[model samples]
Each structure stands twice: as structure tokens, then as C-alpha cells.
Target chain A: MKYSMEDIARFAEGDMDGDERAEFEKVLQADIDLKSGLASYQNIHSSLKMKLSNDDKDKDFKQTLDEVSADYFKQKSKVIPITRYLAWTSAIAAVFVLFLIWSPWQKDLYRQYADTEMIAMVERGENSAALDMQQAANAFNKKDFSVAKATLENVIGAEPGNATARYYYAISLIETGDGAKARIFFSELYKGTSVFKYDAAFYTALSFIKEKNTKSAIVWLRKIPADAAKYDESRELLNKLK
Target chain B: MLKKLHEDHRYIEALLHNDKKVVQEIYAKFAGKIKRYIINNSGSESDAADILQEALIDIYQQARHKAFQLTCPFEPFLLLVCKRKWLNELKKKSVLQVTNIDDALLTIGEDVFADAELLEKQEAEAKHFEQMFEKLGERCKEIISESLKGDAQEMVAEKLGVTYGYLRKKKSECMAALIQLINKN
Candidate 1:
């Protein structure tokens, strides 16, 4: 007897009841081809199960997520920056450009002239000695030294009587890693008028600190005027040296 | 830049430290493999989606906890882990009771689970069945594909422009043809 499609389908779906299953087994025993067909069904189920299990085991879930997420983020970053730039420029460029364009020529010209005048005033206001002192101060701030010493020396050459310049030149020399030359300038400025007296006393102490001569630093610190702003910082440095 | 990683059971562990960039990389690299595996396992798209989500969660856990170490590329490790996790899930379902869990565990060898040759063969077999389904009149193919998805007989009949009785008879005939095609492969 041949197995109909309905019989096989029923069997595949377990539509056969308890006794029907028993009877189907009897039929299977008598027929090799039918047995093979049933086995194929079993194989299909097995293969499907194996494939499912394999899928579960080998799907590389994280790797896939990482790749997709990377692509998405990359796309998002690319799109957002471009769109924001476009929107921002479109919204602002016209007003900003128009403002620049509408500015009066005389105003612009006066602004340049004012800048030039400021430079000229700065150049003429200070004698060569005072200029050297300012240059050395700038160099000290910038941590430049060889040029600073040369500029300080230029100040002394042009005006040996300028105690303010002498004080600053000494400070510059000390800051430039030369405590020896700084001591002489600080001493001269300190002995002169009161203009550089406080600063000179402070830098004289600082120069000794740089030279690691705690004795001379203490002597200069004691000599600094009590009202000088440098008095507190000098006292602290003196304490540190002691 | 190639990341220098610690040698330990910490591949997924490393992933935990990775930013969103790395996570996205992991997903892109493995989604297709997971999808194909789920589909081949008699699962639908929805099933594939669920399985994939679960697999990713598993990887995330393993990674976060420093459980998975990659002796190979991250892709294979993830695949191996997810496949094992899904198989364990199936075993719990008791759909087919006689599975060799040990064999499955052993199957996570260096080059065993997602073997390129096997995937190619599966692809060819799938294509063969698709062609055979195509060879069947289009109506037969639609009816059977829907039926296999567990659609109601009447619904499939209506969808295929056929009466319920004709749909039932035609379904059997179509399934027989599919079985024959499968046998030829």
C-alpha cells in the first residue's frame, strides 16, 4: 500500500493519535521506501534543529552589533556636523558679512592711525635706559635671558643715574640665571634715592636666594621696607631658605 | 588603530571597556551570520530577531563580566557563544529531546561551527529549494510558504486565490514536491 500525502503530512504533524501511531509503525516496518521517507522527515527536523543550535552558537552577536552601531554612529556624526555647519552659516553669514561691509572707511582708517600713534607714543615716552628696563621685564616674563641681560646692560650704559632701571635690570639679571651681576645692580639701586629702594631691596634678597647664599638673602630681606608689597613674599622666601 | 588587549578570558571583557564604536562594530560583523543561522533552523524572521537579541544580550553579559576570551577573532567567539546559548534554550523547549549537548559543546572548535564550506552548501541547498518552489506554479509556492508559516488553512486558501479544499489538496501536493526537491539536494 502506498502512503498518501495526507498520511505523511498527518504523521509529520502528529495528527495520528496513539493507536494511529502504532498502526503507522506497522506500515513502516513492511516498506523500506516509506521508512526512508519518514527518516527524511526526521532528518529535516534534525537538520533544522542543528542549524538552529548552530545559529544560536555561532551568530557572533556582539560583532554584528558593533559593526552596525559603528556604521550608524559614523553616519550620524557625518550628517550632524555638516547639517549644523550649513544651518549655522546660512543663519549668520549674511548679517556678519553685512556688518563688516557697512563699517565706514574713515572709522577703519582712524582705528589704524590710532594703533600707529600708540606705538609711536610708547617709543618716544621712554629714554633708551627706560626702554632697556622694560625690554628686560618683558624678557623675564617670557623666560628669555641672554637678550634680557644685554638689554639691562644697555640701560646702565645710557643712564647710570636711573635707579628704577637699575633695580629692574638687577631683577632681570637674577631671573636670567646670573646672581653675581644682579647683586651689584641691586646694591647700587638700594643705596640711591627711594624710587627703586623697595624693589631693589626685594630683588637683592631674591638674587641671593638664586645664588643659594642664605646669609646675603637674609641681610637684604631685613633691609626691605616694612610697607613694601614684596616684604611678605620676601619673609616667606627667607623662612624657606632658613 | 589596532587595540592591544590583555591575554585572558577577557575578549568580551575588552568589549565592555570599548566605546559605542566597538559595540557597533561587533553588531555589524555578526548580525548576518546570526540571521542566516536562525532562518536555517526553521525559524521565521521574528524568531531570528528574538534569537539575535538574546544572543547579543548574552555576549554583553559575558563581555561585561570578563567571561569570554577570544583565542580567535571576536566574530567566531560570539557566534560560538550565541549558538551554544540558543541550543541550550532549544533544549529547554524540549522540541527534539535527543540532542547531543556534548557534541554541540565540542562543535565550538576553532573552525567548526560557521564553516564557510557548510554555509555555502546550505546556501546552494536553499537556492535549489527556492528554484524548485519557483518551478511549482506561483500560486502553489505562495500557498505552501504561507502554510509552512502556520497560517490557517482558510487564510492561506484565501490569500492564494483558492477554495479551502483545493488549498488543502494543493498544500499536500506542494509539500510532496518540496520534499522531492530536498531529496535531490
Candidate 2:
């Protein structure tokens, strides 16, 4: 109780030893005011210890923490390997990459939708003299897209607005890799009342796929009305996109 | 008394060692509970992030300071303090409290609460000490702050261009003046 502030500072500093520390511990037990003072000194000392030692480290941690938290929100609904969480993040990264490469829509639905199936036929109904519908159909089924493309274009040019010709013509355009012209036909079919309206919307999406623009393809597929023939397929495609 | 080390003591180790994996795991595993609690009780994910960061900083401080160790699962203790801190923050913002904020679902022992409370007190004490330390003469401020830096008090004394004996006396005098200033406030 008679010890100076130096004695208390030594005690708080844990610089006292053996008999010195033991004697002070005894004094510490009996004096409420002395114990309280020691606690204050100790608290202040450690607090400053933290402030100095941890200042730069906390700043570094805050930078990393902000990065981690930002990543958390980006992968919020989906539990993902934190990007900056480094070190074999690639282990979980494989799963994340698998998610990209193997989306249900990308592999199954989009593939199913994208398969042009060699266009079963590029001509419709009794337009025998208008353009060789039968020859075009045979050429298309053989997977000769250039042959199918030229014949389908002649038929469609001779008989524009023929729903069957328009649909098959768009299909051949997409297959022959003229998506620009194909989208023109697909858009026209989608805008007008044809049984192929929904199919045209679907093919419009397919045209985008041929262009390697999946995002725009998704937007076009999403336009398939619920009552349309391809509505279920479009919805499935959107689900995969999600 | 010797405290039993909890398995979650790895969290303290992670902070001490700056292990990014465990730290990210801390966010992945625990951030949602805090986020949901905050958002449900009238706080945004933004508020949740800030509150959780503050709480984690305290946890890191307590983990590094003194002989601090976790004696309980860190989740409840962390969430409880974070929830409490967020509520206090909301109270400061004077935001409308919609759903009556429920107490944390974690069955926190009084010991954990006391430990978290002690960290809070330590932080406030440090803040007060820092402000009061500035009130001392410029020489005392430099010496006092420098004194805490190195284990070799004599080297610190020499660096301050003072004799070893004078270092002790000056530290005691400076510390007393700081305590007195804090007390006067």
C-alpha cells in the first residue's frame, strides 16, 4: 500500500519477480484502490500495445477484409471459393469453373436447341414450279448446308411469307452461317402470326448462338410466350442461364 | 485458473498468423448469420459488413493482446457482440426499429459476455489513453509511446537520449499525469 507509482508501474509491467511479485500480489489482494490502479495501468499499456503493433497490420487486414467481403457479396447466393482467399482456391475453383462450363442450359438445353438437325426440309407445300422444294428438302436432309442454303433462298424469295418456307429458310440461313440474314427472317416470322412465331423466336435465339452472343440469345429466347410451342424449352434455357 | 482451449481457438491463431483461408472461412461460415440478423432487424448488408468488420477487429485485438484465448465456440460470442454492436450503431443512426431485435440465439455463458465486454472496455480505455497521452508535454508523449515499443527499455531510453534511471522515473511521472488527465475528464 505504501509503494510508489513506480512500484505499481513495475507490477503492471510484470517486471517484478519472485519475492517482489509475490509481495505485491499480497498487497494487491488487500488494497481495492491499489488493484484498481494496477488494472488501469495494465489496460492502458496493452491498449497502446495493440494500437502501435496492430496499426499497419489492421490496415492490411482491412484491405484484405474489404476484398473478401466484396467477394462474398458477389458470390452471395452461390457459396464460392473466395477469389482472394488464395492458396488452392482452385480446388473450389474447379467447382466454380465446372459451374460455368456445365450449366444445365449451356450443355443440355442450349445444345438441344442449337442442334440445327441438318434442316429436315427447306421447302413447304405445293410450290413445285416456284422453286425446287423437293430438291431443296433432299439437299437439306443430306446436311449439305450450302446446297440447302441456295435452294431455300430461291424458294423464300419466290414465295416470301410462306410460313413453312420462311421457317425452313431461316433454319438454312442459320445453318449456312448467315445469321445476319437469318435473324432478318426469324424476326419477321416472330413478329407476324405464324405457327412458327415461337419457333422463329427460338431460331432468332439460335442465330445469336451462331454469332457467339449467348447473352442476346438468352434475351431472344426469353421472348417466347408461355403459350408458344417453344415456351417450355425457352424457360428451361433461362433456368440454365440462372 | 487455467481455461480450456476451445477447438475454435484456430480462429485466434488464424488472425495472429494472418491465414487468409481461415479468415475467409470465417466470413463464409459466419457472415450470413450476422447479415440475416442485421437485415431482419432493420440494417442492410452494408451495415452488416461494417459491423462484422468492427467485431472481427475486436476479436483480433483480444486474440493478440495479453494472454487472451478463446474458451468457447467463437460463433455465438462473435455474433452476440456483433448483433449488440449493430443494434448500438442503429440506435446511433436513429433508424426505425421494425421487428423487436431478438437476443442472439446463441447460449452464451456469462464468461464470454464478460470477455467481450472487457474488450470493449479495453478499446475505450485505449481511446481515452491516446487522447490523454497527447495532453502531456511533447517529450513525455514521444517517450511514453516509444517506451511501450521495444522490450529493451534501456534501448528505448537510449533512443530517447535519456539515462536508464531517468526513463523509469519519467515513465511513472508521465503515466501518472495521463491517468490524472483521464480521471479529470
Candidate 3:
């Protein structure tokens, strides 16, 4: 006797009467293919249930995973090159250390904590916007703030909602002595729900510091929560400000 | 026989809870090795990162739904999952010049290997199931999704303006249809 899929489904769902269930179980014990089919159906049923219930939680987890992955890969890529460079520069370490200690840039609070390490954009294709982003990243990393500002302006023109581009563009603006304009972009980013939200807040504080507005900088620094990525740095900078 | 949970189950718990500190430790400890392995096998650091993230998410889903336990250390199991994912990716890309790494280098136990294989199979099935579900008719999709929302059948039936008996019957038919769709593929 061939068992229909509805019969298998009914059995799997426990929707059959006791007598019908008993009869189905008798056949189920003797039929390997039917047993396998029932198992597959049940697996899909439970998996679907789980997937629907956990979809939102899965998205939240993916967001966290993406953030951590970006940070991890960035650091991993730098490790090898930085180590090799350190090895070659170990002989000049004493002079370089002295220079770093007395460097005017090191004394500037705005420059000290402005993490200019733009998250490297993964080159997807030969699209001009992608090319512009790559060029902007290179220019920003090289501290060619003028070029980075120009390139990022073009990127933001094409994709105004590009938060990463906007955030980096703000930093480039600050680097090029346009602290007021940079704060506008930073304030906008801070108000959004991007991963750069706290980073934006922190940079807004830095922008205030660049303008010698220690009072406003303190206010912005205090807004960073202890759980935020920039909280510790903000606290440290707050101490220096006080 | 009940297998003893390894001390490394904390890592699995971390994935479940999205514990960033412990998750970062997992990266700090194990990510470098997996990154090196993938980079050695004709993959980039970005590919390694993607594979690692995907493997962790798969583990998270398995733990969430299947009550997956880590009976062995997490490092080898994580590496095994990531290695398998990268090999599968290379296969999809039709990269013929792939270099295969020996699994023997990692001290993976038999059970860990079996667990990883099961996860890979389940992930493939889940992907197939999701695609097939999209092909289902609107009514069937609504019935199945609404029924799975943990409401009483009568309540769901009322909410959908159907009788309880019809809801149960339709749910069964929808599930059966879904199974057949998967089988047809």
C-alpha cells in the first residue's frame, strides 16, 4: 500500500486519531522509505519554525558579526606589514622616539585621538564610485586630506546616504581645517543608527577640540557611553581637558 | 551515553548570546590560524574573514535550533568548519587550481568531524528549504508562517478568519507541499 504525502504529514503533525496513528506506526516501522520521508518532512517543519522565529535575532547577530569582522580583518592586515617595518626601523627607534615625544602633532589633542584608519573598502568591481572610494581611502590614509575631501565629496554626491564615506569625509574636512563643516557631517552621523554613531560623536568632540572649544568638547565627550567603542578614549581625553 | 561538555562550550555560548568580549577572544586566538590557512589556499584575508564569519553564524544557528554542544575544543572545530566553507566556496567559484590542505594537521576528533559535516548538510538543506518556501503560494505561506508563530491553532485560525480544523488541515498540506518542492529539486 502506497502512503500519500498527506498521510505522512498527518502522522508527522500528530493529527491522526489513535487508531489511525497506531496503523501508521505499524507501517512506519516496516517501511524505511516512509520513515525517511517523515523525518525529512519533520526536519523541514522544525527548521522553518526556527527560521521564522529567529530571523530578527539572526539579523542582529549578523550586524555584530560584520562589525567585528571588519575590525579584525583590518588589524590582521596591518600586523604583518607593521611588524616588518618595525624590524627595519628598530635601529632608528631612539631618534624616532625623541622626535615623537617632542612632535607638535603629538601635543595636539585633536590629532592624537583622531583615528584616521579608514576601514578599507573591499574593491567590488570597476565602478567609478567604488574606484572613488578606493582612491578616497588611499588619500585619507596617506594624510592627503585635500584629495580625500574632493574624492569623498564626489562619492557623497553620488551616494548621499553613504555613512562611511560621509564620516571619513568629515574627518578629512577636520584634517583640512574645516572643523565647522566637519561637525555638520559628524552631527548628522551621530544622529543616525550607523555603526559609526559613537565614532561620529567622538569625532565631533575632536572637532570641538580642534576649534579650541574645550567646553563643548567636554560636553560631547561625556555623551559617549561607557559601552561605546570610544568611551575609554573619550574619558582619557576628558581628563586631559579638565 | 551523555557526552561531557567541553570547557570550550563557553565559545558556543558566546556565539549564542553575542558576547562581544568572548567572541573577540575567539578571533584573537583562532582567527589568525584560519586566516593563514585560507591565504595559503589561494584565498585572500577578506575571503578568510567572510568564511570565518559565516562559519560562526552557522554554528550559532545550529546551537540555537539543534541544541548543538561542543564536546571538543572550539579551535579545531571552528577551523574545520571554516576550512570546509572555503573549499565549498572555491568549488562554487570553479577555481580548479585549488590546493587542498590535510585535516590531520588539526587535532580534530571523530565526533567534531561528524558535527561539522552535519552542520554543513543542515545549512544546505536550510538554504534549499528557504528557496522552496519562497515558491509556495501566498495562502500556504501565510498559513505556515502564522501557525509557526507559537499561537494556539484556534487563535491563529480566528486571526486568519479560518476555522481551527481547516487551519490544521491546510498547515499539513502546506508542509507536505513544501517537502515535495524540496524533493523535486
Index of the highest-DockQ prediction: 3
lDDT of 3 by residue, A1-242 (tens): 57888889888777789898998899989999999888877788777765666565676676666545654564333222222344555547546654653466677877677755554444223357657877887788678999999999998897665667888999999899999999999898788655577888999999899899999999999989875768987898899889
Candidate 3: docking tier: incorrect
**Local lDDT at A205 for model 3:** 93
As for candidate 1, its interface RMSD to one decimal place is 17.8
DockQ per candidate, 2 decimals: 0.05, 0.16, 0.18
- Model 2 residue A149 CA deviation (Å) reads 38
- Where does model 1 exceed 4 Å of error? A4-6, A13-22, A25-35, A39-242, B1-25, B28-74, B77-120, B161-163, B181-185
lDDT score of model 2? 0.69
Report the poorest 10 consecutive residues by lDDT, candidate 3 chain B.
B98-107
**How displaced is residue B132 in candidate 3, in Å?**
3.8
Give lDDT: candidate 2, residue B53.
79
Q: What is the lDDT of residue A66 in candidate 1?
A: 28
| Per-residue accuracy of model 1 over B64-118 as CA lDDT, tens digit each | 3223333444555556655655565567776554333344346455443433223
Deviation from truth (RMSD, Å), model 3:
14.5
Share of reference contacts kept by candidate 2: 0.34
lDDT, candidate 2, B109-148, per-residue tens: 8767766776677777777777777778998888788877
- At residue A217, candidate 3 shows an lDDT of 95
Instruction: Give all TM-scores, in the order shown.
Output: 0.32, 0.54, 0.55
> Which model scores highest in TM-score?
3
